[model samples]
Target: MLNRRHIRVKVMQSLYANLGGESEDFSKDQKFLMQSIYSMYDLYILLISIFIEVRNKGIDQIGKQKQKHLATKEDKNPNTKFVNNEILKFMGDNELILEKIKQQETIDWDLDSEYIDIIFKAIVSSNAYKSYMKTRMSNFQQDKEFITTVFREVIAPNDKLYDYIEDKNLTWLDDLPTINTTILKLLQKLRPNPTKTYLLPELYRDEDDLKFATDLFTKTLLNQNELNEEIKHKTINWDSERLASIDLVLIQMAICELKHFPSIPVKVTINEYLEIAKEYSTPKSSNFINGILDKLVKEYEADGKLNKVGRGLL
Candidate 1:
């Protein structure tokens, strides 16, 4: 699920796309932004399914090796540690995951078998895989740790998988960090259970979260003139032409939140955008944006325009 900062980043991207002339149609661009976010959740599911693919790859290799006419003893009795990893077994039997695969039809690794082959080969060669195979009678904690190491070492950094996923969906690159982190956390939280029902994260926490995304997108677009007027007055010393378009959009968003989002604290809004500016804008943008928004926030306060509600909301 996307937190407020992630949603803000999506809104910032949409605003930048429209303001940057990447796309002139605000409504269409906004729809693309929302879709981009939903696409991220799908990416998460697709990524989780990779573990199953990797396991299947392991199973397939063992079967072929066993059928070799002069197969070695190792081939005849291949280590089944990976195929039987508790976490993988649990996820394989997870009803929700199976249902979602049928429902979404978004995660098809069969067409891209080379990636599964590459990832499986990397795992088979790694010390983590070898060590797990040598361990005897592994518990759930051991199974969880091994898969996490395999994921962090092999799957997460595999160039082939990364390139393939990014090529398939451009939005995956932007979402990779958040989705990977969330999956890792979910993996960490798993414990042995007979119910076999693992909790998959939702796309949004609630309808309010959905509303927040569209509201920020819509309000920023609707109040662009007013927001820019506020920025223009505050940055009288700096030429708007000299400012980065990204910086302009971020500041405009911060202003929108300050005036329109009454429940959000002014300080929280300022800090959030400043942090976002660090990643998406220029190196000096955090402080540059900080100065303009600081002055405007003070001015907005003086004018009694910010009608914040709730305790400590103003």
Candidate 2:
């Protein structure tokens, strides 16, 4: 589910962490980089597991209400619509999902049942829940729509759940938005009955993307001296030490893509880094990096140094 730009962000972050010097343990850093990328899947699993836990909480509550000595007819035969939700049951019973959650061993909602309780309470109080409970009979379309609304409005935005995720893994905070987006998209496309493997998405789109992450990280680190020299003359007015570390790293990565990865177009490289800068660096970073890159691309083109290939790659 991860796209190329997201992979670039991951590479950029690792590069930023080791910006001051060559890492003493390059393999460890590489391992950490891949681990961090894969951990996004774990976060995805953790988020989806909330649905399963909430369903379980509902079942438990219904059982308790049935045993009440002063039970009304409503309590004895409560609306089981939320607990019997088709999508939730599908996720809860899917062997592949359950196995993956257990294998990761990082996310256990049973131990963190309080979060489940918190989300269940939020869901019960939601208008979506009220409208959904009005119908007792299960319909896939209604169940799916109700789930989408609850997830988007209630479960995903709860402050306690957010804090719990933050406390569990710092890197997960960045992945939360992306993972939530992935979940919503999946929910939208889900069939009334899907295969067991439907929810398990591959991390990288293909092997090439996997290679791109490693190559970008390694090439940028190894070509530091050459990349620095390229930036040196362009930024003559600015002290090298005074340059924003993030801007420098972004420039180096962009340059690496331009010269080393000849298949990628020059415009693509420049635009990608500039967007990343707008989001990650100083407010002026996009313009600043753009100016230096514009100058370098001009010089490289004039000197026939740009090795970009394919039509319109320049």
Candidate 3:
């Protein structure tokens, strides 16, 4: 569930916050950043729940309208058949999203009103809805068919619209890093030995390695700038004030692992950071990060600074 890009996004948010705020406290900033990274799942669930609420509201509106009036020939009320049966019912039965909602206690479903509205509008305007309407107009003779078509085409795609809304929604996530940290802390406390008892055996083997990577990453972000002159020198070339804090943290993490983690391959570190940069930074950030890391790796190798071990690591 937690990908490199997600992690980088979290880091970037934290960095941005720290830069904006006048506080010089790195510890506070670090805590804020990590927390945000951890809460991405919760944010996703919140967005989906909002979508569900909007879909339900739309269906309810249509149902109420149908109950109040008898359908005329031209009035072909497709809402009664499609809205209730196809759209609302499917949202109710979606176990994955429902389970996520059930697990979340802090998120208020009512708070998603604006987000829902945007998603609903986007769904109605989508190409999918037009296609459904056209198909229904051609093939189905009954009013019920028209309703079903609208429900299937317009309301069903609300889920997709929710995704679009989420991908574009950033202003609401101003405190995202802080929220993520709180959720992750809760999850960790709830299942401390998850890898030992719940994780698959294959996954357990690399648990330590993954932890090492994450820990190294965390440490580098938290301490490397203050401790390493080489890092400071490289950072001098970039606009530290304007740089996305998340990108800075992720780059530091990647560099730390590249030089310090002997068992991990250079390609893995570079690839991981590149993927992360794409998600958390500006569109051009991945290319920029990739170039810098590539140069750093070559410089490290030429200076006989890299001391990697293990079969696949180079």
Index of the highest-lDDT prediction: 2
- Candidate numbers sorted by lDDT from highest down: 2, 1, 3
Q: Candidate 3: which stretches are off by over 4 Å?
A: 12-31, 69-81, 84-90, 94-96, 102-118, 133-214, 225-227, 232-251, 271-296, 302-304
Q: For model 1, give the 10-residue run with minimal summed lDDT.
A: 20-29
Any residue pairs clashing in model 3, and if so which?
11-246, 12-246, 15-245, 35-180, 35-181, 36-177, 39-180, 78-147
lDDT for 54 in candidate 1 is 84
Evaluated at residue 99, the lDDT of candidate 2 is 85
Worst 10 residues of 2 by lDDT: 17-26
Q: Mind giving the per-residue lDDT tens digits that candidate 1 earns over 1-314?
A: 67889889888877787773222356787788888788887888788888887878777888999999999998898778888888887777787877776576667777778888888889989999888888656988999999988888889988998898888888688788888888788777877784544547787878988898888888888878777778888876767789899999999899888888898999899999999999988999999999998888778789998788888876
Across residues 59-128, which tens digit of lDDT does each residue of candidate 3 receive?
Answer: 7666566566675543546533334433334445667557767887646646645656665675567665
Local distance difference test, candidate 2: 0.89
Pairs that collide in candidate 1 are none
| All candidates: TM-score | 0.92, 0.96, 0.57
Better of 2 and 3 by lDDT: 2
Candidate 3 lDDT score at position 297: 81
Number of the candidate with higher TM-score, 2 or 3: 2
